[model samples]
Target: MGMHKDQRACRRVDCHDRPILSYGHMVRIAHVTDCYLPRTGGIETQVRALARHQAASGHEVSIITATPGVKRSGTEIVDGLAVTRITAKIPGDLPIHPRTRHHVAAALQENPVDVVHVHVGVISPFAWGAIRAAYQLKIPTVVTVHGIWGPLASPGYRLSELIAKWATWGITISAVSQVAAKTIERAVPTLGEVLVLPNGIDVQDWQLPVRQHDSSTLNLVTVMRLAPRKRTLPLLKIVKAAQERAGITMRIHLRLVGDGPERSRAESFVHQHGLKNLVSFTGRLDHAGIREIFAMSDVYVQPSVKESFGIAALEARAAGLPVIARSQTGTTQFIRDHQEGLLAQTDSGMASAIASLAADRALLAQLGEYNRSTAPEQSWPMVLARVDEAYARARHLD
Candidate 1:
């Protein structure tokens, strides 16, 4: 026989040549990821939002993920979508479910989805299995790399880069931002072209927060998982330095609004640096609680060193709050320095920016207003429209 159909399916599609789907046909999409809620992070948030929108648009959508903890397996419905979880073993930061291939095959055999949408990361065993199952079942596949792979330039990550590249071969690949696309293209040159699909938020859900900034206190809020790359400790130090630099004129209260593996270490760093008075960690909050917190905050801070896209920052911007974040991040794509908010290059620069914003409430209000007005374009519908093109490309990637 001529080459098997699975082997022949490795051909790639031209980046811009995918035809847009004419209205009326609803595609059944299976979103396969390594993690999902109640575990919170950028990927989980985006996946949930995408599934919700896709379902609302009259398409059948389901999220397949590994169950957290030592449980064998379970299934639950959240946001009107079915979330299927399989038992897995946790290794280091990533989870490795040895039976992923079998579970995915089983799921495909039963439901037979149209597209297997896999969310890729540095080390995603489950996602890898989903791709394999896609090939086995002859299902079209779309793989989105959500995290930054630029740091993998080091020798240690060379093997991982090759493995991820190999697994993602023959798949329609996408990144969350232009910077992210460039990063992944550099890491995996053979992937041909990577599309930029920006992370989105439900802007209409985030009503502009009524800000009554207390002159006596400057509230700096950061909503992110307390992971190592997030630089939560550095954020605390910056808040302290900004307070010290601003003098007794204004006190800076830093509210950290998430939890992660690095929480204990972050708390230790706070106590060691005598930041007990300035910092408060609010484990994690749901959307309503987070919106309430954002409504009452002055400025939002993003101190992450390895951010692919800043969803939380965008949400804060939508909430009418000026953001002070590190420069050279994907957030800079939407938030221009001095236009929407201030972007800093270093810890010192971030501290300086914080103090400056705190001192000039008028400037803060000006930037916040601009960000809130411009933030609507990053809404879920706009993002999903672009994603539809990617889905079409995945289907036609002969």
Candidate 2:
């Protein structure tokens, strides 16, 4: 069966007066992603949020993902959303599932979706397979780029983009940030028209009362996966350098949150520098746990130089904690330098910014207040409005 743009846009699907779309009719949207709830990352969070928002808007939403350890593959209802999980062996970061194409086809046939949105990445067997299946089924497809790309990652990413371009028809492409869109444009020059769909967070959950720090000891917090691109080890070394310079006059305590591939290396570096007294590693924590930590911290630090969208940093800002991040990253798009937080070019610069904030609590409070006021605009409703526009464009109605 083939899906098409509605001949006449409906003013209401059933009884509500809300127009289906400002430009098109309502659709049963199917989201295909490489990872989901069991896996924790920025992409997982955004996908889950978008699905919830779409369902809340009265659209039937279905999620198709790989079940890494499940013995059986089947449909399940998760928080009012329909999920079809396909059993597969996931080795390393990417899951290699040759059966994904068959699974996707079966799921779509059983569920019958109107729009297929594939969240694309470098090694996404399920996502790539879903895109091909949607094309074969003659369903409209949208590919949202979720992979981070740079000079180092470009070779493989360019290859993947070329393959994607050749594998599907009438596919609309979207990126999570302006930086990501530019990267896609550079990687696939022939694949014209990439939309920028920025990631969003639950602002209400992060709207905490301003944190209070000890007058003598300043608390620094960083919540990120301990990966190479995150620069967690280097960040710890920078903190050690700052503490060494501060000596007995200044006291600095760093609380590192989240666990990842580089955790062991970061821990070794901390031990090598004799920073056990200054740095505390709290492994992985849930949203509530992270919010509690944010409520206690004086400042949030983002060390990743290759972030497509700094969701964690944005969450910290919404919690009324001033951010200090690398100026070269996508975080700069949201957190203005010297306004909401300080952006630094180098490790030494970041250290200096942290030390300055610790010494001046009033300036930090002013920045936090400004961020809290502006952060609500990055909520799920704002994100879904843009997603609706993207869906309209995908249907060739916009």
Give the candidate number with the greatest TM-score: 2
Q: Judge candidate 2 at residue 192 and give its lDDT.
A: 70
Off by over 4 Å in 2: 1-25, 69-71, 89-94, 163-168, 245-247
lDDT of 1 at 30: 90
lDDT of 1: 0.77
Model 1 misplaced regions, further than 4 Å: 1-24, 68-71, 74-78, 88-94, 150-169
What is the TM-score of each predicted model, taking all chains together? 0.85, 0.88
How many clashes show up in model 1? 0
**Model 2 C-alpha lDDT per residue in residues 1-398, reported as the tens digit of each score:** 12233422322222112222443345678999878876767787789888988787777798888754232357777778877778665566355578778779878876666678888665566787887887776666778877566677645565456545743566788877777777777777777767887788878888887545677777889999889878888889778876766667778889999999999998898888788988999999998899888877888998877787798988888888889998877686578888889999998988888888767778877888887777646678778878778777666764
Instruction: State in Å the error of residue 337, model 2.
Output: 1.0
- In terms of lDDT, which candidate is strongest? 1
Native RMSD of candidate 1 (Å): 5.9
Give, for candidate 2, the lowest lDDT window spanning 10 residues.
Answer: 11-20
